[model samples]
Target: MVYDKVIEIIKEEFDVDEVNENTLLREDLGTDSIGLLELVMAIEEEFDIEIEDANLDDIKTVKDVVDSIEKIKG
Candidate 1:
């Protein structure tokens, strides 16, 4: 459910149809660096959490973002 919520946030920000485990934030979703940052900020605000810049480096796909959120939530 968290993953779905995260994906919804991303979709709402980027106006995308769907995002899956393999969806690359940049390539598949057409998100540039600035867009990614904005998305991250929006996610932080929506979830009321902070995602570190270092941790964000490891996030490449939708699944990775979801996993990061789960880790933070845990």
Candidate 2:
């Protein structure tokens, strides 16, 4: 599922020790713009789904990314 994939991407990209639904992208993971872009690209490649620019601004947390990916998949 997208949730699991997102978690995997976050863990791998940030080299985090752990990840949860509440883990924030900027705060907890310290991801900058380039990192965010990389994460988005990874998500797109992994899920075979494209995320729109408009929705990018609204994503601030790991849960948000998971939700957005699920919505796009749906």
Candidate 3:
């Protein structure tokens, strides 16, 4: 599943042990602004797709990211 790979990437990028669909960036992971940008870069490289910078503001949880990847893949 895409989420499986996404979770792995997120775990590695955020230095977290685990991440689920509901995991929130700020509340659950304590991700800062720079970290958020890094996460976007990692996602782009992993999936080989470019995401609009404005859309980054809409991303809040792990599920949002997975959805974005799926949408882009589709």
Each prediction's TM-score against the native? 0.90, 0.93, 0.93
* Candidate number with greatest lDDT: 3
**Tens digits of per-residue lDDT for model 3 on 3-74?**
999899989987899789999987899998888889989989989998888898889999999999999999
Each prediction's whole-model lDDT (CA): 0.86, 0.88, 0.90
lDDT of 3: 0.90
Which regions in candidate 2 have their CA more than 4 angstroms from the true location?
A: none
lDDT of 2 by residue, 1-74 (tens): 77788899889989997999999888888988889999999889988999987787888988999999888878
Clashes of each: 0, 0, 0
TM-score preference between candidates 1 and 2, better one: 2
- Best-to-worst order by TM-score is 3, 2, 1
Over all chains combined, what TM-score does candidate 2 have? 0.93
Q: Which run of 10 residues does model 1 get worst, by summed lDDT?
A: 53-62
Question: What are the per-residue Cα lDDT tens digits for candidate 1 across 2-21?
Answer: 88888889889999887788
Q: Can you tell me which runs of candidate 1 are displaced by over 4 Å? A: none
* lDDT, candidate 2, at 65: 97
